[model samples]
Target: MRHATQLARISSILSATLPPELAGHVWFAGCDGPSAVILTDSPNWVVLIRFQQAQLLEALSHILEVPTCTQIIVRVVPEGLPNGYLTQR
Candidate 1:
């Protein structure tokens, strides 16, 4: 429950931080220790997000009031599928 809440908060922050064109395409999936897990609807968005990884981490750190995330794990998960499918596969 706490984890989900944190992810939700991060997602909200990410939505605001990302450009309008990329906003709805990216989301905070979860966290892996000091790393942030991200999911995107397309591989194209993954590439774009990676280009902004450093800035995104900094924003997340400042917004969440936590230590800077050490890494980001971005995955492509097609839209309309249940998010849990990522773990299942």
Candidate 2:
């Protein structure tokens, strides 16, 4: 299993590259041992991401790949979270 430190590290790195709007939209992202997951909320899309081992990094390499993931999950979050901007890249 992945430690909290590893998850924190990955989350930090992921947060840095996010667009200003997407800053707070992404709740968390990190490696859970050899796997990883990312949580993102948007007005139009509430996305949950999961990957095996290094695949997360590989998918992240192509920004669109992340959003286009076949395993992505989406659902409404009641009142919703803060509004973060995700510039149309």
Q: Which has the greatest lDDT?
A: 1
Model 2, CA-based lDDT: 0.42
Model 1 scores worst on lDDT over the 10 consecutive residues at: 80-89
**Model 2 poorest ten-residue lDDT run:** 80-89
Model 1 / residue 64 / CA error / Å: 2.6
Tens-digit lDDT track for model 2 on 1-89?
24444444445555556555554545434334433345555444332233231344554545433533333332334464323322211
Candidate 2: Cα lDDT at 41: 56
Q: Residues 1-89, candidate 1, lDDT per residue (tens digit)?
A: 56656666677777788888887776787668988888888888888888778878888888767864778899887655344333322
Provide TM-scores for the models: 0.75, 0.39
CA shift at 57, candidate 2, in angstroms? Answer: 4.5
Q: What are the clashing pairs of model 2? A: 21-84, 21-85, 21-86, 22-85, 34-53
